[model samples]
Target chain A: MSRALDTVAAWVLGALWIAPLVYALWAAVHPEAYAARFDLAAPLTFENFARAWAQAPFPRYILNTFVLVTAILAAQLVLCTLAAYGFARFAFPGRDTLFMLVLVQLMIVPEVLIVENYATMARLGLVDTILGIGLPYMASAFGIFLLRQTFKSIPKELDDAARIEGCGALGLLARVYVPLARPTLVAYALVSISHHWNNFLWPLIVTNSPEVRPITVGLAIFGAPESGVSWPLVSAATLISVTPLLLAFLIFQRQFVQSFLHAGIK
Target chain B: MRIRDWATGYLLILPAAAVLAAFTHLPIVRTVRDSLFSRGSAIRPARFVGLDNFEALAADPVFWKVLGNNLAFALGTVPASIALALAMALLVDRKLKGQGVLRLAYFLPTMLPMIAAANLWLFFYTPDIGLLDQILGRFGLPGRNWLGDPATVLPCLMTMTVWKEAGFFMIFYLAALQTQPPELKEAARLEGAGRWVYFRRVLFPMLMPTTMFVLINAVLNAFKLVDHLFVLTKGGPNNASNLLLYYIFEHAFAFNDLPAAAALTAVLLALLAGLAVTQFALLDRRVHYR
Candidate 1:
C-alpha cells in the first residue's frame, strides 16, 4: 500500500514537471488552429518554426549569443585564474580584504548597478557595444571563489617542484596549476556558459541595435507588449532560443549536474 | 623559486582583478556617488544633491509598495518552492520503478531559461484563449484574469517563479539526500514508525543544513531575480506587482532618475547585507548533529 502511494505521488509530480516542456514542444510543432487541441492524432508541422525564424533575425541572434557567451567565458577564465591564484597561493597584503570585496560582487550583481554602469558605459562610449554587454560579467565572483577553493586543495609541494624545475611563475601556472585544475576549469566554464547564455537584463540595457542583441533580448522584443505575439510562434522562438543550452545540457547532463553540485558544495 | 612564485601568482590574478575593478567594484563606487546627485536629464549632467534622493524615497509611497510587493513575492515563493522541492526530492528518493526517468523529468524545467519560462507562462495565462482558462472552462469553473488583474498578478508571477525554481532547488535536496545514511531510515522503519513520523523525527533533522542553504538562496533569488516580470506583468495593474528590482530598473532606465535608483539600490544592498548577517548568526547558533 505504501509503495503504491509513493508510485502515485511520483507520477503526479513527474507529470507536473514534464507537462510544460511537452506542451511547448506540442505548441511549437503544431499549427495555430490545433495549439489548444489535446488530440494525440493532431499532425505536427514545422511551419511555426519557419514563421518564427523569418519573423525575427534568429540566426543573427544565435550568432550574437555565441559571441557573448564565448567572450565572457574567455575573459572569465583568464581573470578568474589569476585572481584565484593570488588568493590561493600568495601572501600579499590586503589579500583577504580584496577577496572579500570580490565575493561581495557575488551577492550584488551588475543588474543592481545597471543605472550607474549605464552612465559609465555612456561616458566611455561603449553603450550598444558587445563589449559593454559582456564587460561587467567578465570577472565573476563565483568563478574566482570557486577556482580559489579548487586551487587551495592542490599540494604546495607541486608548486615547489615546478620551481625546482627552474620554471618561471607563468610557466608554473601554465604547466602545473592549469593542468591540475582542468576539472574545475571545465566545471566553471560550463556554469559560466549556461549563465551568460540565459542572461537578459544587462544585455537588454546595453544593446539597442539588433546587430548586437543576444537571443534572450531578441526573444523579448518578439514578446514585448507592443508586438502582438502569436502563441505558436512565440513558443517556436523560445524553443529556438533555448535549443543550444538545452542540447548542451542533454549531452553533458551528468557533468552539468555534477559541476553545479561541486560548485555548491564548495 | 620565490621570485618566480610571486611573479606567477601576480600574473595569474592580473586579468581577473582588472575586469573586477572595471566592471563590478568601480561601478558600485560610481553608483554610490551617483545616488548622491540628481540627474538633470537622460543625456545631461547630474548635479550633487546629497541624501535628497534618499529623503525623496522616504516620502514616496510607491517605494514602500514595491518593497512590500517584494516581501510578498519572497513570502509566496521561497517556502512554497522549497517545500515542493523537498517533497519532490523525497518522492524521487524512494526506490520505485522508473524513478530515474521521474528524476530527469522533475529536473528538466531547471534547464530551460527564465525568459522562455516567462513567455510560456504568459501564453498559459492569456484570457479566454489560453490553456489554463480552457481547462477551467471544461471544468465549469470561472477563469481568472491572471496577469491582467492586480489581485492575481503577483500570485501569477509567483506561480511561474515557483515552477522554474523548484526543480533547481530539488537538485540540492537530492544531493543532500544521497549523502544521508540509509541505516537511520531503515532503523526507524523497523521500529514500526510511520513514514510521516520517520520523516519528521529522523529525515527532517538531517536536512536542516540543506534547508538553511536553500532559504538563503531563495531569499537572494527573490530579491535579485525578476526576469519573468519583463514579459509577464511589467509591474502591471496599477503597479501591484512592482517588485523592488523592477522598480529600480524603471527609475534608472525609464524615468532616468539615477539618484533615486541608486538610493533604492542602497536600500536593497543594506537589506541583502542584513540577510547575510542574519543567516550567519542563525547558522552559528544552530547545532547540526549530522
Candidate 2:
C-alpha cells in the first residue's frame, strides 16, 4: 500500500513538470485559431514558425547572441584563469583582502551596478556596443572562485614537476593547469553561455539599437502591452530564441548535467 | 609550497585584478559618490547634495512600497521553494521505477532560459483562450487575471519563480543526500521510527548545512532575479509588483532620476550585505559544530 501511494504521487509530480513544456511545443506547432481549442483533430501546421521567423530578424538575433556568448566566454576564460591561478599559487600583501573584495562582487552583481555602469559606459563611449554589454561580466567572481577551487584540488607535485621541466608561470599554467582543469573550464563555459544568453536586464539598459540587442531583448519587442499576446507567435519566437541552447543541452545532456554537478561540488 | 609561489601567483592574477578594479570596484565607489549628488537632468552637471537623495527616498512612498514588495517576494519564494525542492529531492532519491526520467523532467525547466519560461507562463496566464482559463471553464470557475490584477500579480509571479527555481535548488539537496551516510537512516528504520521521525531526527539534521547554503542562495537570487518581471508584469497594475531592481531601473531610465536610483541602489547594497553577514554567521556556527 505504501509503495503504491509513492508511485502514484511520483507520477502526478512528473506530469506537472512535463505538462508546460509539452503545452509549449503543442502551441508552437498549432495554428493561432486552434491555440485555445484543445481538439485532437486540429491540424498542426508550421505556419507559426514561418510567420515568427519573418516577423523578426531572428537570424540576426541568433548571430548576435552567439557572438555575445562566445565573446564573453572567451574574455572570462582569460580573466578567470589568471585570477584563479594567482589565488591558488601566490602570496602577496593584501592577498586575502583583495580576494575578499573580489568575492564581494559575487554578492553585488552587474544589475545592482547598472546605474553607475551606464554612466561609466556613456563616459567611455561604449554605450550600445556589444563590448559594453559584455564588459561588466567579463571578470566573473563565481568563475574565479570555481577555478580557484579546482586549481586547489590539484596536487603540488604537478606544479613542481612542471617547474622542474623549466616551465615559467605562464608556461606551467598553459602546459599543466589548463589541461588538468579541462572539465572545470568546460563546465564554466556551459554555465556562462546559458547565463549571458538569457541575460536581459543589463543588455536592455545598455543597448538601444538592434545592432547590439541579444535574443532576450529581441523577445521583448514581440511582447506587447497594448494588444493581447498571440500565443502561437510568441511560443514560436520563444522556441526560436531558445532552440540553440536547448539543442546544445539535448546534444550534450550528459556533459551538461555533469558540469552542473561539478560546479556544485566546487 | 612556500612564499615564493605566492609572488608569482599575484603577478599572474594582475590582469584580472585590473579589470575587476576598474569595472566592479570603481563603479561601486562611483555609485556611492553619485548617490550624494543631484543631477537635474542628464545634460546637467551633478551637484553635491550630501544625503539629500537618501532623504528624498525615505520620504517617497513608492520606495517603501517597492522594498515591501521585494521583501514579500523573498518571503513568499524562499521558504516555499526550499521546501518544494527538498520534497522533490526526497522523491527523486527514492528507489523507484523510472526515477531517472522523473529527475530529468523535474530539472528541465532549470535548463531553459528565464525568458523562455517567462514567455511560457505569460501564455498560461492570458485571460481568454489561455490553457488555464480553458481548464477552469470546464469546472465552472472564474479564471483569474493573473498578471493584470494587483491583488494577484505578486503571487502569480511567485508561482512562476517557484517553478523555475525549485528544481535548481533540488540539485543541491540531492548532492547533499548522496553524500549522507546511509547507516543512520537504516539504523533509524530498524528502530521502528516512522518516516517522519526518521526524516526529522536523522535526515533533516544531516541536511542542515545544505539547507543553510540553499537558503542564502535562494534569498540572494530572489533579490537579483527580475527577468520574469520583464515579460510577465513590468511592475504593472499600479506598480504592485515593482521590485527594488525594477524600481531602480525605472527611476534611472524612465523617470530620469539618477540620484534617486543611486540612493535606492545603496539600500539594496545594504540589504545584500546584511544577508551576506548573516549567512557567514550561520556558516561560522556550522563550522564550529564540525
Candidate 3:
C-alpha cells in the first residue's frame, strides 16, 4: 500500500510540476481561443508563432543573446584559467587575501551593486551595449574558484614534467592545466551560458534598446502592459525565446544535469 | 627566479583580480559613498546629504512593505521548496519506475528562465481567461485576479518561485543522497527500524550540511529572484508584492533616485554579508567533512 502510495504521489507531483510547460506548449501550438480551454476539437495552427515572431525582433534578440553568452563564456574561461593557475601553482605574497577578495564576488554578486555598476558602465560609455551586460560578469569568482579547485587536484609531478620539457608558465597552463580541466571547463561553460542566457534584471536596467537586449529582457518588454497581452502570442514568444536553451537542454539533458550537479557539488 | 615567479603570479591573476575589484568590490565602496549624496538633476548637482537617503528609507512605507514581503517571500519559498526538494530527492533515491522521466519533469522548471516562467504563469493566473480559472470554473469555483489583487499577489509570486527553486535544490539533495553508504540502510533494516525512524535518525542528520547550503542559497535567492516581478505585477496594487531588489530597481530607474537606491542596496548588502558569513562558515565545515 505504501509503495503504491509513493508511486501515485510522485507521478502526481511530476504532472503538477510539468503542467505549466505543457500548457505553454498547448497555447503556443493552438489559437488564442483554445488557450484557456481544453478542446480536443480545437484546430492547431502555427499562426501564433508567426504573429509572435512578427510582433518583435526575436531574431535580433536571439543573436544578441548568443553573442552575449559567447563573449561572457570566452572571457570567463581565459580570465579564470589564468587566475586559477596563479592560485594553484604560485606562492605569491597576498595570494590568500587576493583569493578571498575574488571570493567576495561569489556572494555580493554584480546584481547587488547595480546602482554603482550602472554608473561605472555609464562612465565607461558601455551602456546599451552587449559588452556592458557581459562585462560585469566576465570575471566570475565561481569560475575562478571551480577552476582553482580543479587545478589544485592535478598532480604536482605533471607540472614538474611540463617544466622539464621547457614549458613556460603560459605553455604549461595551455598544455597541462587546460587539457586536464576540460570537464570542469565544460561544466562551468554550460552553467555560465544558461545563467547569462536567462539573466534579466541587470540587462533590463542597463539596456534600453532592443539592439543589445537579451531574449529575457526582450520577452519582458514584449509582454509589457503597453503592449496588450495575448496569451497565445505571449506563450509563442516565450517558447521562441527559450527554445535555444530549452532544446539544447532537452537534447543534452544528461550532460546538462550532470553539469549542474558538478557545479552544485563544488 | 624569485622575481620571475612573482611576475608570473601577478601577471596571471591581474586580469581576473582587476575586474573583480572594479565590478564587485569597488562598486560596493562606491555605493556606500554615493548613498550619502542625493540624486543629481539638470537644475542642481548631487550634493552631500548625510543619512538623508537612509532617513527617507526608514520613513518610506513602500520600503517597509517590500522588506516585509521579502521576509514573507523567504518564509513562504525557502522551507516549502526545501521540503518538496527533500521529498522529491527521497522519492527518486530509491528504485522507482520511470524515475528518469519523473526527475526530468521536476527539474525542467529549474532550467527555464524566471522571466519565461513568469510569462507562462501570467497566462495561467489571468482572470476568467486563464487556465486556473477555467479549471476552477469547471469545479464550480470562482475566478481570482491572482496578480491583480494585492492579497494574493505575493503568494502567487512565491508559488511560482517555489516551483522554480524546488527542483534545483532537489539535485543537491540527490547528490548528497548518492554519497550515503548503502550499508547504513542495510543495518537499519536488520535492526527493524521503520522507514520514518531510519530517515529521522540517519538520513536527516546526514543531509544537514546540504540543508545549510540550501538555506543560505534560498535566502540569497529571496533577495535576488525579482525577475518575475517585472512581468507579473511590477510591484503593483500599492507595492503589495514588492521585494527589496525590485524596490531598489524602481527607486533607481523608475523614480530616478540613485541615492535612495543606494540606501536600499546598502541594506541588501548587509543582509547578503550576514548570509555570506554564515555560508562561508558552513562551507568551511563542509570542506572539512569531505
Candidate 4:
C-alpha cells in the first residue's frame, strides 16, 4: 500500500513540477485569447513566435550568448588547465599562497565585486563589450580546483614516461594531462557553459546595446511588464531563450546528469 | 636544457594568477578602500571619509529592510527546498516505474535561465488572469494581487525560488545517493530496519556531507540569485522584496553612487566570508566524527 502511495506521490509531484513548462508550451503555441483558457480545442499558431521574434533582437542576443559562453569556456579551460597542472605537478615558490588567493574567488565571487570590477573594466576600456561580461569569470576558481584534484590523481609514472619521451611542460599538458583529465574538463565545461549562459547581472550591467547583451538580458527587457507585451509573446520569447540549453539537456540528459554529479563530487 | 620545473610551474600559473588578481583580489581591496571614501565629484575627487559610507549604511532603513527580507528569503526558501530535494532524490533512487520521466519532469527548472523562469512565473502571478488566480476562481475565490501587494511579494518570490532551486539541489542528492554501497541497504533490510529507521540511521547520516554542502550552497544562493527580482518585483511594491545584491545593483547602477555600493558590497563580502568560515568549521567537525 505504501509503495503505491510513494509512486502516486512521485508522479503527482513530477506533474506539478513540469506544469509551468507545459503552461509555457500551452500559452506560447496558442493564440493570446486561448493562453489562459484550457479548451482542448484551442487553435495552435506559430504567430506568437513570429511576433516575439519581430519584437525583439533575439537572434543577435542569442549570438552574443553563444559567443560569450564559448569564449568564457575556452578561456577557463585553458587557464584552469595550466593552473591546475602547475599546482598538481610542480613545487613552485609561493604556489600554495597563490593557490589560496585563487581559492578566495570561490568565496568572493565576481558578482559580489561588481562595483570595483566595473571600474576595472572601464579602466581596461572593456565596458559595453562581451569581453567585459566574460573576463571576470574566465579564471574560474571552481574549475581550477576541480581540475587540480583530477590532475593530482593521474599516475606519476605516466608523467615521468611522457617527460622521457621529449614532452615539455606545455607539450605534456596539452597531450597528456588534458586527455587524462577529460572527464573533469567535460564536467567543468558543462557547469561553466550553463552557468555563463544563464548569468545575468554582470552581463546586464556590462552590455547596454542589443549588439552585446545576452539573450537573458534581452529577454528581461523584452518581457519587462512595462514593455506591455502579452503573456503569449513573453512565453514565446522565454521558450526561444531556453530551447537550446533545454534541448541539449534533454538529448544528453544522462551525461548532463553525470557531469553535474562529477562536478559536485569533486 | 629545460628550465627548473618549479620556475616553469610559476610561468604556467601566471596567466590565471594575473586574471584572478585583476578581477577578484584587486577588486576586493578596492571595494574595501572605496567603502572608506567619499563619492567624489570632478572638483572634490574621492577623498577619505572613513566609515562614513558604513555609517550611512547602518542608518539606512532600506538596507535594514533588505537585510531582513534577505534573511526571510533565505529562511523561507533554503530549508524547504533542501527537504523537498532530499525527498525527490529518495523517490527517484528506488526501483520505480517511469522513473526517467519523473526525473526529467523534476529537473526541467534547472535547465531554464532565471530570467526565463521569472518570466514564466510572472504569468502565474498576473492578478486575475494568472494561473494561480484562475485555479482559485474555480473555487469561487477572488484573486489577490500576488506580486503587486507588499505582503505577498516576498513570499511569491520565495515560492518561485524554491520551485527553481529544489530540482537543482535534488540532482546533487540523487548523485550522492547513487554512489552509496548497495550492501548498506541490504544489511539494514536483513536487520529488519523499517524505512524510517534506515533513513534516520543510515541514509541521513551518510548524506550529511552532501546535505551540508547543499545547505551552504542554498544559503549563499539566496543572497546571490536576485535575477527573479528584476523580472517579478524589481524589489517593489515599496522595497518589499529587495535583496542585498539587488540593492547594491541599484546603488551603483540606478543611483550611480559608487561609494555607497562599495560599502554594501563590503558588507556582502564579509557575510560571505563568515559563511565560508562556518562551512570549513562544520566540514572540519564532520571530518573529526568520520
Give the best candidate by DockQ.
Answer: 4
Could you tell which candidate, 2 or 3, scores higher by lDDT?
3
Listed per model, the TM-scores of chain A against the true chain A are 0.97, 0.95, 0.98, 0.98
lDDT of each: 0.86, 0.86, 0.91, 0.92
lDDT of 3 by residue, A131-197 (tens): 9999999999999999999999999999899899999999999999999999999999999988999
RMSD of each: 2.0, 2.0, 1.4, 1.4
C-alpha lDDT (0 to 100) for residue B172 of candidate 3: 91
**Recovered native contacts, candidate 2:** 0.68
Compose the digit string of candidate 4's lDDT tens values, residues A70-107: 99999999999999999989886788998988889888
Error of 2 at A46 (Å): 0.4
Better of 1 and 3 by TM-score: 3
Candidate 4, DockQ score (0 to 1): 0.86
Best-to-worst TM-score order: 4, 3, 2, 1
CAPRI verdict (incorrect, acceptable, medium, high) for model 2:
medium
lDDT (Cα, tens digit) per residue for candidate 3, span B13-114: 999989998999999998898889988889999999999999999998888898999999999999999999999999887888999999999999988999
By TM-score, how accurate is candidate 4? Answer: 0.98
**Candidate 4, B182-233: lDDT as tens digits:** 9999999999999999999999999998999899899999988899999998
Candidate with the larger lDDT of 1 and 3: 3
In model 2 chain B, which range of ten residues has the least summed lDDT?
A: B1-10
- List fnat per candidate, in order: 0.68, 0.68, 0.85, 0.84
Off by over 4 Å in 3: B284-290
